[model samples]
Target chain A: MRNRFNEQLEQLNVELIKMGALCEEAISAATKAYVEGDRELGERARSLEQDIDHKERDIESQCMKLLLRQQPVAKDLRAVSAALRMISDMERIGDQAADIAEIARYMEKSAILRQVPMEEMALAAIKMVTDSVDSFVRGDLALAHSVIAQDDQVDSLFLSVREKLTALIAGGENGGLCLDLLMIAKYFERIGDHACNIAQWVEYAITGDYEDD
Target chain B: MRNRFNEQLEQLNVELIKMGALCEEAISAATKAYVEGDRELGERARSLEQDIDHKERDIESQCMKLLLRQQPVAKDLRAVSAALRMISDMERIGDQAADIAEIARYMEKSAILRQVPMEEMALAAIKMVTDSVDSFVRGDLALAHSVIAQDDQVDSLFLSVREKLTALIAGGENGGLCLDLLMIAKYFERIGDHACNIAQWVEYAITGDYEDD
Candidate 1:
């Protein structure tokens, strides 16, 4: 029974890694679509979001079953509870990625990506998300803290993006377009927040200490 | 033992309602600050948010104890899990309300509330939040659905606010101020979403069905 429980725990890790990969793919597709003005990539990201949703439900049920049958205690219980919390954050990351894609689909044909450092910001967000999941899969507290630290960079980038968009609007650029870009930047900032949340859950799973911040 | 569990469950319900009321007060205070340009109300809202946070941690520990000690199953298990999900949403509502208050603190002295129907929007969002918690406390599925339905109104109000702000920017109003108002509107919209999330969790607690939408 112990071995079986361990095997189930391993399976949970694998499923979470799969979900994280899908989230990364969704965000990358959305960012690519936004930068390149391609609606197809945005549509693909939306589909990926659906897959992430299904994965969340699947993992959620698995966690419930483990809790019911195994009645895990101590570190094992923490790991399962942390998994439960982490998936919610991961699912939000997927949703935010899909939101970014939806905004991309509605964007005007003219590229506004050049006006702001959105591409770099997107890259930073994606890396933070990837590293967060990596930290969870490996139970590496250092990696998790690094992912948490990266949120400040994403936040500062968002402020810079806002400043640039405000400058564009003041310079008589298209108000609608600048507003849309600002929304997209805001979505990226939210994605960073979700990533940070995941990292915090990972830390909790490993150390049994939920960092308050 | 069963009676004890029920009593504990009732305590949990009471705590959740307290948290929900705090959320409503925070949003109301923030909105009043925004409309009146009162920094004092904004500060009050911020402090209320801190109280909400402490309540979240307190209730979280209670739920964890209930889960571990009771080893609840079936409907009881569902109730605990639903509480787990609901508190996260409630906590987010508090955070978003505080975010609105922070924006109000920085808003220009000019009255932007007259230009948009933000007062109506804030009221609608607060109602949804109140009704969502009411549904949870009473297990009223119909009330929960009503809260869900109200989200569309809040969303439309956000779009209207965006339109008005866009027009203001186009007409040579302060772009920065308009953007800040837009941010505040977005925060209210987010508060509505969190309320909707709470209502969904309430449904799940009562019916074991997680509504997908």
Candidate 2:
């Protein structure tokens, strides 16, 4: 029974990594799509989001089955419950990625986006998502802590993006387009937040300390 | 054992309702503070958010204890898990309220906020929070569905707020203040999303269906 539980735990880890990879792919696709004004990529990102949703449900049932069958206690219970919490964050990351893609569909200001340079912001947010999941998979407490601290970087990037957009307006760029870019930047910041949340859960799962800021 | 579990579940309900009330109060206080430029109310809102955070931690451990002790399966398990999920959303609602308060602290434009009429948006989001919690308490599927649908109203209100802010900028209001107001509107929209999430968890608890949009 212990062997079987361990095997299932291993399976959960694999599934989580797959979900994380999908999230990374989704946001990357959406960001690239928006930056290049590629409608096909936007469409693909939305489909990736649906896959992420299905994975959330799939991983959720897996966790439930682990709980019911193993009746895990103590640290094992925390590990499984943390998986449950982590997936919720992953699901939201997917949603934010798709939301960015949705804006991309309507936004043809690839030049304006390049001018304000949200791609950097998107990359930073995506790195957080990737590192957070990596922290969970490797059980690296230091990585998790760094991921949490990285939120400041993403936030500062967002502020700079806003400043650039505002500067673009002062330079006679369209205010309307700046608003859309601002929304997109906000979505990326939210994705970073979700990543930070995943890292926090990873910390709780490992150290039994949950801190919210 | 079953009776004790039932009592604990009832206790959870009471705690959840209290947390919900705190969320409502926090948002209401923040909105009033922003609209009236009342620093005292903003301070009270921030304090209430701290209370909401404590309530979240308290309820989380309560759910963990119930799960660890009772080893509840099937519907009872679902109920406990759903409460766990619901508190996360409530915590986020508290955060959004405090974020609004933070914005309010720097904003002395009571007249401007009134001109944009975000009071209506705040009230709408607050109602969603109240009804979502009520649905959880009553297990009212219809009410949960209504709360989910009410997101559209909050969203349309956000669009109108955006439109008005744009017009205000066109009319020579500080573009910077409009941007801040826009952020405040987005935060309210996020509060609605969190409320929608809570209602969805309420629905899942009752119907075992989890839908994400």
Specify the highest-DockQ model's number.
Answer: 1
Per-residue lDDT of A1-213 in model 2, one digit per residue for the tens? 989999999999999999999999999999988888889999989999999999988998898778777878777888998999899889888888888899889865547766765878888899999999999999999999998999999899888887887676666565566677888899999999999999999999898888987
Residues B77-150 of candidate 2: C-alpha lDDT, one tens digit per residue: 88998998899889888888988999889865646767876889999999999999999999999999999999
Best by lDDT: 1
Backbone Cα, N, C clashes tallied per candidate: 0, 0
Displacement of residue A18 (Cα, Å) in model 2 is 1.0
| Candidate 2 stretches greater than 4 Å from native | B108-110
lDDT of 1: 0.89
True contacts kept of each: 0.25, 0.00
Tell me the TM-score of each prediction against the true structure: 0.96, 0.95
Quality of candidate 1 docking, DockQ? 0.58
After the best TM-score superposition of candidate 1, give how far the Cα of residue A200 lies from its true spot, in angstroms: 1.2
Misplaced by over 4 Å in model 1 are none
For residues B1-213, could you state the per-residue lDDT of candidate 1 as single tens digits? Answer: 899999999999999999999999999999998888889999999898888888987887788778777878878988888888888888888888888889888877765569888998999999999999999988999999999999999999999999988888898777777778888889999899999999998898889899867
